[model samples]
Target chain A: MKHQRKPCSLEHARFLRARKKNLAIVWALRIGLLVLLLGIWELVTAVGWSDPFLTSSPSRIAKTIAGLYSDGSLFYHIGVTLAETLIGFAIAVAAGCLIALALWWSETLRKVLEPYIVVLNALPKIALGPLIIIWFGTGSKAIVFMTVLVGIIVAILHMLNAFIATDKNKILLLRSMGASKLQILLKLVIPSSLASFISMLKIAVGMAWIGSIMGEYIVSRAGLGYLIVYGGQVFKLDLVMSATCILCVLAAGMYFLVVLLEKVLVKNPDS
Target chain B: MKKEMLRFSSVTYIYHTVRGETEATRGLSFTVEEGEFVAVIGPSGCGKSTLLSLAAGLLKPSEGEVTRSGSCGYMLQRDELFPWRTIEKNLYLPLEVSKQNSPELRRRAKDLAVKYGLGEFLQSYPPQLSGGMRQRAALIRTLATDPDLLLLDEPFSALDYQTRLNVTADVAEIIRSEGKTALLITHDISEAISLADRVLVLSGRPARVSYTHELDFGDLKNPLKRRESAGFSGWFEILWKELNQ
Candidate 1:
């Protein structure tokens, strides 16, 4: 039987209007809350309720950003940090996929290397900072290496779980049709694990940021991390706060990019 | 020669795990002749699924020989339609995996989708379709490989009781129309009676063939029509007794 939906156009329009109104309120509240917090901070500092030196005022941060913008160093720092993060995130995803595939392809190799991977994952990656600097030298290479080091393990773990957890029934279905190992992997294993791959990318993006920042804390000539370190050392509280705020915006931007990519790549039911 | 499509000569299957071995089926012997529709009914957890696994050559018989002619297609209980793929793409999977995804074959698969009442849902993913539609897509997927023998393992169990009846009838009609030999494993005695040209009642695990019934309701092809036949309840009653015993 053909489905017959009641065409209550008036009710439908009213429902849509209510939904839109509620959504607009939610967004308005979100922005309003942020503005209120910033306004309070500015008020407190301007009215001498708190020491501006200890707690940097929003106006001071804005003035510091304006200063950096005129100096041409702001874009340079943002560029360096973004490039490092993107490169590190890319390398880690590619290498981690290859490693996960290797582990999946050979049970013996997986068994032999599984323990070492676990140990590496458990060990604090920041401890390896000094050694990484020495091996790659005190440059962007060291920071990139650190970023990759932080991100690759989690990527491998997420993907390996997904690969191993491929539906055994689907594999059997393929095998019954005379499909070979490569056929099954290409047709079933990888395609079915796309969600896991995207999840790993999301997680690894955060790791990449942490690694780059941590590396700069150890040693760096330029980048957002360096700006923060330099600002801290010079007792420029406004610069420190400004750099941190920029980092937050950039990280959130990259995360949204990944979310957009998920929209494009994953055919998720809800998405 | 009746052109044997599949023959299981005293097959025995033993499951090995960390907790040791469990014999799922033992001395299980049967033959599916060409163009036959056979249903196997047994107690729950009676290694009915194991029988299909062995027929599909996914499991080795520990003690007996299994000879199957041509390719085998397996239809699962949950439909196992890839959630990411559209109905058309889902049907194309077997062909793609088999490396026979020619334009001609793709067209044929699309045609099958249209013919099977999935025409409107060609671009819709499995999740968008109802449970019964998903199962139909899965059956079409299995049939895409043009397998000589189809092994159906409780393919209708996941549906609601009402949908189950309709889908069982639909699927049985499709299999018959395709002229492929089918070995269906179901616990539903009425389902077995309605769909099968022959019914094999199985013993409890280490399951073996307990008894066999040859059914003849001349021109009683459709599952609903077969169920409505005067002889249908007679077969259900006999199989029920055999299964209980």
Candidate 2:
């Protein structure tokens, strides 16, 4: 048995080596593509093939970011946006889960409110921008509300579907064991929907960022969105580009954070 | 003189949908006595599941009386083990839900797993185990809370033929050794004849007990042994004819 197992282990090792090599090649290609794109953009602007003033190159964006760093405003703008996004995301997930539970608890309530939820999810959220500013008066409060608004509806829908789609047999088993409704919810429904919850978080991260940026675009004194608006108005395209780059990095970082959370919480990949 | 564990007397169940109300079972009457392994066989889509649900007390009868003496454990067609939980944790689920959580019950549940050849895979999740092992885990889970009656709804139908035979033997051994009353609903004639002390056959839709038979195997409790017995084919033929008619 030991002699037979040796060849099988050797085959498994070879398979693992091939997989690692393939992953390395994919990563190298991804990085190479990004570098090539940036290099070409720089070359085009420097050779005067494209106007640098209109479309800021990588170097100009970097220089603008460096200047923002020296003035200590880069971190400030990032912090404001990040705070709004995190708080809004946390609130949206918590409140959405609670509301979904409430809906699951009472079928009558869900029936009455489901149509309105569908309508709200359908109606473009940006259409409420002007009213939002009037109500909250152009502050961080308004931005946070916007972020929550964008994310909460999707969260509710995703979680509610997951809760309802729980296996009927498992519920029947629980009922046979004399489990109450609350017991069923706690022991079965909530735990079973965890995969959906993680997926919802992944989606809500993107929505949260969009909401904060959209809110900032409508009204903000300091944020990446504000920087872009101010730079565009004053014709400083490099500052706008720099702010956009920072937003991309921030969004990616937030998305990875959620991915990390999914890894920690969801032990069963099949589930 | 045997104690009645479950009694369903002229039980009727109606399911209401947007289209209309459909009667799943009508005037279904049966009684399972203590330490009896009774198998109820029916045609496919003959409200077998509705019968199990009614026995488990998950659905109340629309017309007749349904009485269960004590708490019952239900095992479904699919193993229905929570994929997210390890086999051990899945076994503890019933105990947790029924508020029977204690060291003694947990230990007994673990002992059952070890006794049933699942000791090595107790820490493994449902997906990691084979189909037969998962079903065994599911049975152990059902027995965890020590319910008085076991309501089995075609628990072996999901398995392939080979695994189904082995699992049938294992389940019969466990239920018999544990001395629990079990009411298993299945469409498999051989399974009904092999594992059950008494067999009840149901008619097509709007199910009712059309026939009942007490096997003369006397002390023959092992499922595989019963299958190899001379009387097994005769019993199977009778049941098949009854079901077809």
| Poorly placed runs, candidate 1 (over 4 Å) | A1-8, A268-271
Report chain B TM per candidate. 0.97, 0.97
Candidate 2, A170-259: lDDT as tens digits? 888888888899999998999999989999999999999998998898888988989989999999999999999999999999999889
lDDT of 2 by residue, B46-120 (tens): 899988888877788899999989888898888988888888999999999878899999999999999999999
Instruction: Report the Cα interface RMSD of each model, rounded to 1 decimal.
Output: 1.5, 1.6
What are the fnat scores of the candidates, in the order listed? Answer: 0.74, 0.81
> Which residue pairs in candidate 2 have backbone atoms (N, alpha carbon, C) closer than 3 angstroms, thus clashing?
none
Model 1 scores a C-alpha lDDT of 0.90
TM-scores of all candidate predictions against the true structure = 0.95, 0.96
Q: Write down the worst ten-residue block by lDDT for model 1 chain A.
A: A1-10
Question: Where does candidate 2 stray beyond 4 Å?
Answer: A1-9, A269-271
Chain B TM-score, model 2, reads 0.97
For model 1 the local lDDT of residue A193 reads: 93
> Residue B31 error for model 2, in Å?
1.7
